[model samples]
Target: MSNIKGKLIALGGGDDDVLLKLIRSEICDIHSHIEVIATATTEPVESGNAYKEAFEELGCSNVRFMHIDEANAADTTDHIERISKAGVIFFTGGDQVRLASFLNSTKLLEIMRRRFREEEIIISGTSAGAAIMSDCMIYDGYGHYSLIKGEMKTTHGCAFIKNVFIDTHFAERGRFGRLAHAVAHDPEYIGIGLSEETGIIISEGNQVEVFGPGVVTVIDASNTRFSNTREVEENEPIAVEHLIMHLLVKDYRYYLKERLFQPLTQTMPKEEAGNVALPEK
Candidate 1:
């Protein structure tokens, strides 16, 4: 597979919705002109066009909307052709479970893999769309600070990015609980908690750059010192320690390659400052 050097962003819900400025910024950096394609995974036939209007506001003449639900209406080759040829693909936020069920093992998923592999194609998702980027996705809600049992479910993400668990509307929704739950269950992943209107661009070098108006929380437990809550039951507060979370703000960059953080302009802090010390795990 080719190196996926193209810019890829996972945005929280409330992105520059109608203007799509953030989305356009990523696309225009690589391509002179962008061909925007909108896919609605959650909407019914009646309301699917809602996202399409968002794309139209960017004033791209070549914007096309493809209903993945309509993939069954056409042959597999047609589906592949439509997706593979696009310059940028945008997945609208809604029910991520609905999105996964419709796209998994389908021609659309394959083409998405191919498009990323070939280079110059940007893939972006927001909210439920953002949640679906992880290999293990949170499909449904279970009250607060919870997930349905056996609901520690796994699904096919676009795999544009890997080993990273994503949750959107992070700060606003108090989603720290959701992301912490995911990391606690599986410590191997680095949880990406995106606040509303905020996004993080994961470059090919694995660098995660924060964008938009809010914060992108990075929960790094890969080298956690301790956790003794294995026997603990669900919804119960488990103890943990040394869980590192860095808030990446706009114009700041976190490079995954060097494992270093840098501010966009000088006079800003080069080293990340915040470290969450949880109860012993």
Candidate 2:
């Protein structure tokens, strides 16, 4: 189980002004330090600069970039210190495989996990970066092929979030089938499909609040009646029953530990006569 007390913002590809503002708010002020890890991107320098510019435009002055271009960069003491000092860390989009290959078991990852669990830092990632936030991540597979049993390729992720699988560029890329197949394979895990420009901010390890312009799709196979995942061969169409789905928009909240979905209004407490009472869902 993940004991992370920090905030994690997982975003799909495209505009992230809202996310940047949120990160800034979590930190000190315009002078608060922010680190951007562009290891997943092929053009790390370019991507890093882009984020630096974006943050700077948002009135942030102390923004740094870290890239795993070489084998030893992730393990260097300098890199570790830089990550430790940051109030907020962000990851840019590209190929998740590359990011995992470079930082999976490195000292950088170790520090990141420790800081997240021990401090009040904020971690944000987009696209491929978002996909790697869970224990089990979808590394590869398209919508059409993903529906077939054993077609989607998955790998171990950073494991910042437990018992959940994340996929980005969901609605825009038509990845419902991909997430559905993933949920069918492991009914115990919740599959989150994030559309472009949308994201989920996970707090206190379990509470997830949806944000942005697009939708956030939650696929819960916990009560699935049946699936032929093990019996079917590769390329064979999969069959599943009773998979629950929640199409959430901005302000919707989902509790991972309870597998419950509720609007933000319902989850918030009502203050009346010096007494606080939470609304029952």
Candidate 3:
């Protein structure tokens, strides 16, 4: 991650005016060349056109989209050429398992990673796209059963960043257990659970600035003193001690290198986060 020269974003979906404007001003201007990758969605054309229109609505006329199925996953003739021309690359939501597997070890993926590391290109994704940005990704897991020893499943991801795993639709889907399990096992990586209508923009390959209306849960297992994950059976519940969790809101920041959280200075303040009023029954 230290070598990365790009901006990486993990979005949890929905069209927010703030997010759109952020892309326009902070990410890329309307004149910047953008490429939308629809490899995750089964309906590539539909997803691709939708993003194209969204960008166009933001006055980004140069936005183009393409689908990389198994057929063309390795094509270097046109696909590779297009990537070289891109200033910002976006991935749409769909099946994360399919996206990672389809683009695995391909020349297309190779160049994309290379450009991301060497250039100031912005590489971003939503939902499944967001989930595949790490080297290890959870392909299958239910929130309800994730605490069990062997309930979660992971595979090699695109490796845009190392020692980190991402999960999308956090609040709506109740995916805390799965993320907990992942970090508990790995212990070194941080598990980021991004809720819908929310996302994080990773800058300098170490810090992430949270955006949108929802919460971003950061699961850190680095301080663990005890864990029975090594002794638990398949259906048995696994218990781990000292699994640290951080809740972040809009404008908050988290540093991957130091494993620290930054509350927007004096704007909202970190102490106020715990003072949220509960909903009346």
Candidate 4:
């Protein structure tokens, strides 16, 4: 439930009709303004146009396409104004680096974060967009070599959410080792691997509800008895013991503060929101 004022929605990747409908429900109404950001994509116009169409198909009359790149000014009065009026800010998938590097500390991001924290608006992203939600993110890591020490890369993210690392296309790309290695390297932060087409709605800072098809894997290493990340050579695989993990699907919820997962009871909240995989009809 988006009972809280602020909400963050992260999608692993892929778009589904049901997921789009769920996203629509986050806005105050169909008439609410939506800004589709394609800054992460190489073809921002085409990518932004597609999402603009998708939201319009959901009956959003005031959807606008926004593309910010190295060549443009992100904090212009016009961009700031549109972001202020937007009810939902949607980020399209592409390169996480381009997305974060461009907007990391912009006044535009400050406004968006403020609105998300103080208003009923939503801050949502997919794929690369999803990966940039955490304070630190996995910028690079191939699935096959992610386990090797120093293979995965991390850097400052949007910091919309803290003490966590997010990875998209988890299941499809077989990124378990990639994320596992990340958790071992930075055990202070929990690891969330979102499968393609899956997503999680995060609210009240710690509550996560699953809403799409696929799997949401949560990795916690706070209680690990041992780790060799410090001693492992650059090419050697790191290790961690006593690491905890949980898998969630639709109708399940995981609490970051509690580090626990529970099946939704029959009395689940009518309103659901947050990141990763869901089942297909």
| The candidate that achieves the highest lDDT relative to the unseen native structure | 2
Instruction: List per-candidate RMSD values in Å.
Output: 5.0, 5.3, 6.7, 6.2
Candidate 1 local lDDT, residue 77: 72
lDDT, candidate 2, 214-278, per-residue tens: 88999988777788877888779989988899998887898776777788888544332224222
lDDT of each: 0.64, 0.83, 0.82, 0.82
Worst 10 residues of 4 by lDDT: 272-281
Clashing pairs in 1: 207-256, 227-281, 228-281, 240-279
Return the clash pairs for model 3, or none.
none
Candidate 2: what lDDT?
0.83
Clashes (backbone N, CA, C under 3 Å), per candidate, total 4, 0, 0, 17
- The 10 consecutive residues of candidate 3 with the worst lDDT sum are 272-281
- For model 2 the local lDDT of residue 128 reads 89
Q: Report lDDT (Cα) of residue 162, candidate 4.
A: 80
Q: List ranges where model 4 is wrong by over 4 Å.
A: 1-4, 266-281
lDDT of 4 by residue, 1-281 (tens): 23347788888887655556777987748888889889999899898998899989888889998768878878989999999999888888899988999998899999987787778788888999889887899988887688788888888888777878888988888888878878877776789989887889998767788878788999987777788877889998777788788998988888775565778774434343333222111
Clash pairs of candidate 2?
A: none
State every prediction's TM-score relative to the real structure: 0.80, 0.91, 0.90, 0.90
**Candidate 3, 1-281: lDDT as tens digits:** 56789888778766545555677776546788888988888888897988899989988879888668766655668888888878888888899988888888788888888888899988888889899998999877797798898888889999888878889988888889999998888887889999888999987677788888889999988888878777788899989998889998886787786777777573434454334232111
